[model samples]
Each structure stands twice: as C-alpha cells, then as structure tokens.
Target chain A: MSAAGRTVRPVSIASFAQSQNVRKDNERNEAEGLQPVIAEVFANVGITKDDVDFICSGSTDYLIGGPFSFVMALDAVGVWPPRAESHVEMDGAWALYEAWVLFQEGEIDAALVYAFGRSSLGDLNEILTLQLDPYYEAPLWPDIVSLNALQARAMIDAGKATEADFAAIASRSRRDALSNPKAQVRHDVAPDVLLEDDYVVAPLRRHALPPITDGAAAIVLAAGDKALQWSERPVWITGFDHRMETHSLGARDLTVSPSTAKAAEVAGVADGNVDIAEIHAPFAHQELIIAEALGLDDSVAVNPSGGPLAANPLMSAGLIRIGEAASRIRAGQADRAVAHATSGPCLQQNLVCVLEGA
Target chain B: MAERCAVIGVGQTHHKAKREDVSIAGLVREAAKMALADADLTWSDIDAVVIGKAPDMFEGNMMPEIYLAPALGAVGKPMFRVHTAGSVGGSTAIVAAHLISSGIHKRVLTVAYEKQSDSDAMWALSVPQPFAAPLLAGAGGYFAPHIRAYMRRSGAPDHIGRMVAVKDRKNAMRNPYAHLHLADIDMKMVEESMMLWDPLRYLEACPSSDGAAAMVLAAEDAVSGHYPPAWVHGMAMRSEPTMFAGRDQINPQAGRDCSADVYAQAGVTDPRAQFDCAEVYVPFSWYEPMWLENLGFCGQGDGWKLTEAGATAFDGDIPWNASGGVLSSNPIGASGMLRFLEVAMQVRGQAGEHQVDGAKLALGQAYGGGSQFFSMWVVGSAKP
Candidate 1:
C-alpha cells in the first residue's frame, strides 16, 4: 500500500464527555468551561489525570483573538507534576489520531485527548475566512456560510442534490437532537417547514446552518489490557485514517469529497455493517456529500447525537463525532459505527474512524 | 514493538528578518524541495506531511498548512499541523517520527516555520487579554526577569550572558544560513548594545526572522542509505502549568523530567560525557546556562561556571549550539526544529564548516510557554 498503512494496535475510546453546547459561555473561560467536561470523562472511567500517560489538545488561537490559548487551557487537566503533552492547531479528531499513533508504538497504555473552542468570541465568518488562501481568496472575505453556499450551489447545479434535500438533513438532525440534553439547537421541525425558512446564503437556508457554539469535549483512550479494564463494553477503534485535498476551490468538483472517500476507504468503513454514522457536517448539504463519500445506505442511522448541525463547536465538533459514535457503540445502541471530522474550507481535509463493540 | 526511525534528509531556509521575495507557500516549498532532493526522493515518495508553526496570528493566517498543502505536495495525502507554542517545531518532528516508529507510515515529511515578518510578533505574542496581567512587554520582558532570577540564585556575574552572546554570534559566522552574522561580535560589543530589558542587551536576545526547517524521516528499512542516516535514539515531551505556586521557573521540573525520560530511553547517563554536543533553545543568552542545569548537563548553579570554563564552546568537551542556535536565528516555530536538525546534521557529518568533528551522539532540546513545555530528542550516528 505505497509503503504505508501498517497494522496498528487496537485502541478503545474508554470514555467521552462534552461541555453543554451554548451560544456563548460568557461566565467561564475556556479552561473553566472545560474543567467539568474533563472531570466527567475521567470520572466516567473511574480514573483521574494521573491515570493517563499523555495529554494532547486541539484548538485554534484565532478563535480567542490571541496566541497560545491552548496553553492556558492546560489548566483543566491540572498538570501539577508535569505530563507528556502536545497540541494541534487543527481539530480534536487529529489529536486523537496522534494519540492512537503513539499507542501503536506500545509505549504508554492510556492518553487523554481534548479540544476547546469559543466560536462566539469573534466573528466566526471573518475568523473562518482567514483560514482560506491569504493572497487569493481570504482577501475577498468570503464568509464561511457563503463558501458552503457555493458548495451547495455547485451540488444543486450538478443535480446531485436540491434545496429540499439540505432542509431534510437539517430537519432530521435537530429532531434527533431533542434526546441529546447537551445539544444547543434541538427542535422537531419538518423538512417542508424548514424549506419555508429564508436562505442565509442562496441555496442554504437558516435551518441548514449550524448554531455558533462555545464548548469543549474530551475522550480518554486506552490500549491493550487497559482498554478492557476501563469499560465493561469498550468501543474499540478498528481503523482510523485522514486525508486532504487541494485548497483551490475552482480545481475541485464540489459535488463530491474525494478526501473523505479516500480516508473512508483507508479506514475500512465498508468492511462491516455501519449501524450508525456520526458525521461532522457543519453545513447541512455537506452531510449528503460525506454520507455518499462514506458509501453508506439508508439503513445506516446518521447523527444520533444530532451531529454538528444542532451543536457545532468549531474545533470540538469533529471530535464530538467520534465521541458520539463510540458512545452509541458502548451503550449497545449500535454494533458498528463510522465517525468523520473535516477541516479547512469546503472540507479540504477529512478524518475517518471506524469503531466496533465486541 | 516500535520500528526504528531515522533522519534521511534535512534542509532549511537562509534565515532573514524579512523574506519579502517569497510568499508563505513559496518559503516552505524551498525547504521541502531541498529536503526531498537531499533524500534523493520526490514528493510522491512522502507518505504524509506534518507541519508546525508558533501560531496562526504570527502570519495573520489561520492554519496556513491547509492552504500550503498543495505547495508541499500533500494533496491526496494526510497532512497534520502541530502548535505547542515555541516547542512546536520539535514536537512536529517527534510526531512525524512516530508515524514511522509506530510502523504506520514508511516515509514522512515534516516542516516547521514562522513568517514573523508578516505580522508584528511582539504584538502578536503579547496581545492584551480582558482581565489578565498584560504581557505588552513581549517575550523579552517576560523572560528577562527569569534571567535575572537565574543570575540572583546562581551568583553568576553579568558577563556570562555577554560571553554567550559573543560565542553564538561567532558560531553563526561559520554557518551560512544563520540570520545574524555578527563577525565583529565580542564581549565589548555585546556589553555596549542597547539594553532592551535591564541586564539583557539587544545582542543577548534572539532576532525575529523568517525561515523554515524541514526533514524527511523514514522507517529503518525504507532508508536509501545514500546519505548516512542519523538514527533517532529517543524523544520525549512534557508540560506543566505556566505559573504555579512554588514552581521552579529557574530550572523547571518539566524540563528535567522530560530530559530524564528521553535519556532513559536512549540509555544515556552522565549527559555531559555521554553526548558529544547539544543544540538547545536559548532565545535569550542566559538561557544557555539556565538550560544546562535544567537538562542536567551540569549541576544547578554550576551551569554558568561551565560556560565560563569553555565547556560548551566549539573546542570544549561538550559543545552547544554549533549551528548558531536560536539566539542567532529565531523563527519562533522553526527555531526548535533547527535545534533538532542541527544535531541530525552533526551526526550525519553534513553540518559543513560548523560541523563538530567526529560527533557520534548529540542532544536537541526545546522549551516553550514560560519554560513549562519541553521537547527533547537524542540522535546517534550508529544504529541504536
């Protein structure tokens, strides 16, 4: 396989906890908001910060309008005696991937992966616009909603999907989110009613847009014997891989996500029956593209936790996808699941994780 | 078990205060291309790409790797970004190494850089927060007190910092890519320089530069052997709270713990004698001696004595910063990688004029976030 893709040791998501999704957590700082979530994740598995061998976090400084925001967020973990730690500027899904890779080395048995973001702190549209090509696209200040709208229009023109399809996805997600106590935008609106909503940017309507959320999420991972020790029903990560596409919007066919397709294939998503899929689709129409790329059929229940549509917390949304999928498997709601995380404009990069319960 | 990983290629940009000629993508490409050429491989040979930088604010672009992915030939391949403060560059290399050492990938390309010229780094680093203490004085003002603390505790004369400033600048003269080529640097010149912070002259601090460093790491079996590989022996990272009650800021416990973890893996004891040389992150001149104690190269309070005795010079028993180190060329993010890369270069005998003769083993250390984050690695010429 191109001299890559060697076998990795089995790692399990022992526990997962997320902060209550909210529009703005004005009362608490990033670290303070994350403390309880970290406590929950640790307490879920009956462990503490001392039990984990390493700690890694995912976040972006741009959201906080400063540099090294992740540095201060380390307080939540209470690294008193010092700990082996690292951070990623991307999403928490990648942070988990890194920890999983280290697990393959047969070094430490457990690690903590977390991500925090306060999307409400700044103009998410302007902040996300800065993520584009500086010289070519970012200068134009095409907000995130407008960029996703461009992708939606391209899909509509290709006859791959329609405005009604986008609303249907959003309608199903928010309705499912009603059961999720932590979800920010839980509702029971129907597709027809959602279609009546005015478009935020042409093809994409207000219902299709994700709520601007400020939150954090954490997942405790254990490998080998520790995985079995952590949970009575451990959700084992069977396969994990991530891929990237070129940044040029004009060069890519917006109708499909080749990166997702490649990552899904590499992660062996089709190897078993995927009973549930937790896809991080910030934009409703993008969910269709990701589902198609994952090669899932109608039988596969999607967004059981409402996905990112109901509570998209920027950096943590993708990580929450994995947490949700693993939680479903651990709760005996599913036997097999697929979790996907996306970054960059129009999903230029994507990560896929396949989980199963023994 | 983990597979062995080795450095098969290394390349870096000619550091400057402002690389106005090239775009961010173009600047990174220069180092990536050179690393590929050195490895006798093409972009297609790389299984994945791992990049690191200080912060998106430094360049005014958020996560620039997404945009520069195509430029680094990361399309259709996995690309990752690391941001662990100033130690990010070393952490980036360690992550890339793990890809091979873990047997998940054969050959991976890692790059770390900082285009500080794009934005005012001083302003970006010290941006005001709502109710927190203002760090408007930038890193120098924040660290100057720590340096002063070292002086007060160690009972070392002020000239020790001036000697380090002179030593690294002279070493930079031998290294062509170094940003500061102070051929005339001496104790007198450093002593006469403007005092940016009390007890810290302008010459004693690192210069803000635009540069990038890259390396191509491969699994043991994947190496072509065209160039003598610098085998990675051990690598580690540790972190602690920035400010804690009774924390030893002078010689951080995290740094000592990190170095101990790495040394144990590398089967190293008596670091001063076990390693031939070391490249440490010393943004300010006094950090050279401060790190000596933290890294266990010498005893606490004796690090300045080692410096004064010429124990860390090129001709000394344990030379430090033979490639000018961070003091001569600080790209913030890339500075840590340069430390790791220089040791790899030394072991490969590819350091040219700045090469330490017959260097068989060496250490590379990087710290960030008020000396709370530490990343260190040991490399050897022989297969460990």
Candidate 2:
C-alpha cells in the first residue's frame, strides 16, 4: 500500500483518569483541577512523569478568556527539567492522535495526553458564536443551539427522524449515566415525559441539550514493552483518523454526517464486529445521525457510559469517549469497539478510533 | 522507524502593518496558494492541513481553523490546529512534517499566521487573571527586566544592542517581503530612537505586522518540486514551567536541551561551525546576544563579543536573520515559522537576494511565554 493509505502501528491506552463532572468548579483553577487527574493517570500505571518520553495536551484559550492557558496548565505536570511537549487547540482526542502518530515513528515508548475546559467561565452560548465565520455568520451572532436545531429540523423534514427519536436518545443516555460515577446528569425519566419539556430551541427540548460541565481528563499511551507492563489486557488502537467538511452550513446535508462516514471508513471501523461504541454527540439528534453514519447495527451497544449527554466537557468530551471505550475493552466487556469525536458546528468535522483487545 | 521527509515548497505574504485589503481567510490563503504553486501541486494533492497561531483572543475568533477549512481547501480532508504560544508556528510545522515522517501521509500542508492588526496584542497579553498578578506592562515590560538581567550578567556594553539593531535592519532592506525597510538604518538612528521599556529602545523591538507563512512537506519518494528539497535532518521541542525558583532565564535549560537534542540528531559537535546560518527568534535587539549564548553559538557571556567584532553582519562569516527575522517583521504566531521556512529556503538556495552563499545547513529556533517554551529544527541540503 502507499504511505498515504497504509495503516498505522497500534498503540495501547495504559490508563485513564478524569475529574468529577460539575456545572461549576469554582474552587480549583485549570492547573489545580488537572493536578489530581494527571497524578491519577500516572499513578494508575505505577509510573512517574519520567517514564513518558513526550507529553501533549488539547485546550483553548477562549475558555479561560486569556491567552496561553495551556502554559499555566503545564505547572500541573511539574516539568522541572523540561520535556518534549506539544499542544493542540482542538480536543484531547486529537492530542491522543498526535501522540499515537509519534509512537509510530519508533522514537518514543510512552506518552501522556490530556485536556481541560470550564464551560462555566463565560457565556458559552455567546462565546461559541465567535467560532463562526467572522466575515459572514459571526456578525449575526447565531447561537450554537440554534444551529443544532436547524440540523434537527432538517432531519425531521426529511422524514429520517422525529422529535421522539431525540427524546428516546436522551432518555437512554441519561439512564445509562446512572452507572457512571463521574457523569454529571443521570435520570430514569421516560421518553414521553422528556417530550413535554420546554424547548430551548424549536424541535429541541432542554433534555436534548448537553449539560454545562467543568472537567479535565488524562490518558497514558504505551507502545511495545510499556504496553505489556502497564495493562493486563492491553486495548490496542488499531486504527485512527479524522476528517473535516466545509464550514458553510448551506453547503452540507445537515441530515447526515458525511465527515463521520468518511472518517469511519478511513479508520476501518466496520472491518470487524463492533461490540460497543462511545459516541461524542452533544445534542440528542446528533447521536442518531452519527450512529447511522458509523454503520453500526442494533447489536452494537452505543454510549454505555452515557457519552456527551451525561458529561460534555468542552475540550475533554471527545477524549472521554476514547477513554470510555478503552475502559470497556480492558474490563472485558467487549473484544472490539468504536470511539467517535466531533468538532465544529453540526458535526462539521469528525474523528474515529477503532480499538481491540489482545 | 521514521520515513525521511523534506520541504518541497515554501511561501509567504508581503508582510505589512495592516493588510486591510484582505480578510483573515484571504491572508492565509494567499500564502497557501503560493506554497501549492511552488510545489507544482493542487489543493487535491494535499492529504491533510495543519494550522497554528498564537491565541484565539488575538483575533477574537475561537479556533479559526474551522472557518478556514473551506477557504484552504481542507473540506473532506483531515484538518488539525496547534497552539503552543509563540513557539506554535515552529511546532505547527513539526507536527505537519511528522505526518509524512511517520508514513501516515505522503504529502502535508502546514500554515501559521497572525493578524495582530485585528486587535491590540498588548491588551490581549495584559488581561488580568484571578489569583495571579496581572501583566500590566505587556510583553515589552515583562522582557525588559530579563534583558537588564542579561546585561548585568554578561557585562556587555549598551552599544552592543544598537549594533544588532543596525545589522538586522540593514539586512531587511535586501528582502522585499520584509515588513520594515529602513534604508538609512544605522547606529546613530538606533541610538536616537525613543525608549519604550527601560534599556530597550522602540526601534530595537519588532514591528507588529499581519502575515502568514506556509510550506508543503513531502516524503522522500513524494518529493518532485521545481526547487531542491530541504531535507529534514533533525527536529525537537522542549518546554519548562513559566516560573520556578533558581531558574536561569538568561540561559534557559530548555533552550539548551532543545538545541542539544537537534544537534545530536544531526551529528553536530559544534553548531557555530556546522551550520551555515540561523534564523533565531530575536524579538528585541538585545535578544540577539542573549540567544546567541543560549543557542550555543558562543560560550557564556561571550555572545556580545561576536556582535562587536561584526561577525554577525550580512557579510559576516555566520550571518543571522538574513531574512530580517522577528526584528524586522513579527506577526506573533507567524514569526516562529518564518524562521523555520527561511532556514529551509537557505538550504534550498531559494532565499533570492538574502540567500546566504553556498548555504547547505541551517538552524531555525523560536521561543514563547516568558522564554519557557522552545522549539528548534535543523535542515540540510542532503537527506539524512
């Protein structure tokens, strides 16, 4: 195969840790909130900072309303002698992808990946508006919820899904959250009752929206000998890839996720049996769109850990999906699984990672 | 093992104080188009695109990569964004190069840019944070004391900084794309310039400009451009804390370790003798001497001696910043990448008027955030 299309070397997720998801973490700052999570990830594998050859993080300065927020967050790692490090403004899932790419180079045996965000810091609805095209969409100050609603409405008009389906997804995800200790929203309410809730936007009820969360997550990636030493049942990342669609909403088919489909195909998510999937869909209708794009069957258990619906930490949500899927495999819940992450409005970009146990 | 990678194309915009004619997307696409044209490739040929910038607050846009995807022809392709403060530009290129080096993609395009004219950088840098003392004086005030510290430690004469200001500006006149072209730049003019931060003159500092830089990196088998490829010999990045007890701000261990790692990878026992030239991030005139010692170009405290002897001039044996560097055109986020691509230009003999004669190997370096974040690379004419 050509270098561009050839598969990448497999890397194992040795350990994962995250802070308790909350609406407002007023007590701890970014570094303070991340300190315990970073320590827990390292401690879980009985290793120190020196064990990892490289470190990478995913975060945004916009969350803190200051520049270089990642700079101060480095204090949590206590890099006294300095370390080989890099940061991405996307999300923790991309950070993991970056470290995974470096592992393929055969230069490093282990790496640490992390991400943190506090959605409670500012007006998230207004702040997210700035992510639109400054020359066109941003001038109108379109809220994120309205954009997602447009997609939901598009799905309804196409006869692909209904408001009831959105309610059903929200009901199942929140019910699953009852078992997840770190999840912020957990309930056993029925879909019919959820349908009666007031709409934050037309066709989208309050339950369909993700809860505001302040949280941090960390994952340690191990290759070769380190994988065997750290994990009893190593969950290897067999394939990983991400794709982006055009930013213009009018140019895309909002009822479907072509980016997700393309990324899933490239990551070989359907090459084998998928026992479970952890999908990062902030809105209820998105879960259905992404699941259909992934080509998953009814046999596949989706969002067993409640997914973004239960705890959608801005930059950390996508990474949490990968960690949750890897954890299920390590726990012997499934032999193979698919994890998905998304960025941009209406899932304009998507990432897919296929994991399997040895 | 990693696959060999090379820079097949490089391009930049005509830097200016304000590119009012172009939007953010227009500025970045201008550079990207030039890079693709130089490589003899189209947008479809690029498998992925990676972009980097200083901060979202600089332009009041959160993660502009999402908006820029369509403009850069990233739709239906993998798009990545990197942010590591001022060093983000260099690290951004390193990440794009790795896509090829790791054999994941045969060809990759990387871009770094800054439109500081969109907003006030000083205001963005001085925003007060809870529980931390605000940087009320902006960047210059924060670094001026460091310059004073270096002056005290090195015992270098004050005139040494004026000499560096004179040399870089004179070199800028030869580069058409440079933001500052002071035709009559000299020691007298530099001395007469008004002082901003104590011990640092206004003319001794970098000019705020709007620009972008881009490059197309390809695997060894994929290199088929019009110009010679600048082979990737070594690349590295190191970062330390912003503050700590007993930290040597003058000669940071992070900078030393970063250079040491790259030099080791390239098998350079003596950087001053091995590399033909370097494009180091000297945002202030005094930084030329300070970074000279920090980058191991000279022994401790002896960096000023090289400047005083005219060894760092355009005609000097080891010319620095032949492309004018940050001292002439600083677009914050794009400044670091200018160093990286300028070195690539040197090795490829595509530097045009500022081309260092017979340049075969060169170094590119950038640092950010209180001189803690460091990224460096060594490129050569021959493949590793």
Q: Write the per-residue lDDT of candidate 1 for residues A187-267, one digit (tens) a residue.
A: 999899999999889988999899999999999999878899999998989889999999989999988999999988888
Which ten residues in a row are the worst by lDDT in model 1 chain B? B218-227
Q: What is the TM-score of chain A alone in each candidate?
A: 0.98, 0.98
Write model 1 residue lDDT over B58-119, tens digit each, in one string.
Answer: 98999998999999999999999999999999999999999889888999999999999999
**Consecutive 10-residue window with the lowest summed lDDT within model 2 chain A:** A1-10
Give fnat (model 2).
0.85
- After TM-score superposition, the amount by which residue A292's alpha carbon in candidate 2 deviates from its true location, in angstroms, is 1.1
Error of 1 at B159 (Å): 0.1
User: What DockQ was computed for model 1?
Assistant: 0.86
At residue B75, give the lDDT of candidate 2: 93
